[model samples]
Target: MVKEIERAGIPVVHVCTVVPISLTVGANRIVPAVAIPHPLGNPALGKEDEKALRKQLVLKALKALETEVQEQTVFDK
Candidate 1:
């Protein structure tokens, strides 16, 4: 799907929790989130904690949209 979108000359951004897997799948524009089930928030955590985590990871994902790179990338702390 991502490749197809890019092939159509449309810019693509893949926000994912799994970094290595996305690269294996040939994802060019990828952002590494925290976990697989909840990319934005963890249900087990308190509301405040979940919000903070989502905010941090979402910021990383947004930053990725602005940056340019040659190879596959993963945003990690």
Candidate 2:
């Protein structure tokens, strides 16, 4: 699906927690989240902590939107 989208000339920004997987699959724009299963938060953590973490990562993703690059970019916190 992602490759198809790219083939269609649509710019894609992939938001994922895993870095290597996205690159291996040839994703153009990649943003790393917090986790694999739970990309936003961990249930084990407190609500406040989880919310803060989510907010921070989301900000990073937004920052990624402003930059232009030719290769795959991973936003890490």
Candidate 3:
């Protein structure tokens, strides 16, 4: 799906816990997720802090969208 979207001239940033898979599948832009169960937030954190962490992850994804990449790229926190 990500490859198809890019083939159509639309940029996509894939956020996932397994970055290697994203790269192998030809995702041009990738963001590292927290974990498989809760990719957006860490349960060990307080409620508010977890929310903030999720927000930061989203913001990083947005930033990755704005970046130009010649090949598969991973945006790390």
Q: Best candidate, TM-score-wise? A: 3
Give the clashing pairs for model 1.
none
What TM-score, over all chains together, does every model reach? 0.77, 0.75, 0.92
lDDT of 2 by residue, 2-51 (tens): 56788898777778877789888988778887678899887888999999
Ranking by lDDT: 3, 2, 1
RMSD of 3: 1.0
Indicate the worst ten consecutive residues by lDDT in candidate 1: 68-77
Candidate 3 pairs with clashing backbones? none
* Candidate lDDT values, in order: 0.76, 0.79, 0.93
Better of 1 and 2 by lDDT: 2
Ranked by TM-score, the better of candidates 1 and 2 is 1
lDDT string for model 1 (17-75, tens) is 77778888877778776678877788999999999988887777777767886776665
* Candidate 1 ranges beyond 4 A from true positions: none
Q: Return the candidate ranking by TM-score, descending.
A: 3, 1, 2
Q: Give the Å shift of residue 54 in candidate 1.
A: 0.8
Residue 72, candidate 1: Cα error in Å is: 1.4
Question: What lDDT does model 1 reach?
Answer: 0.76
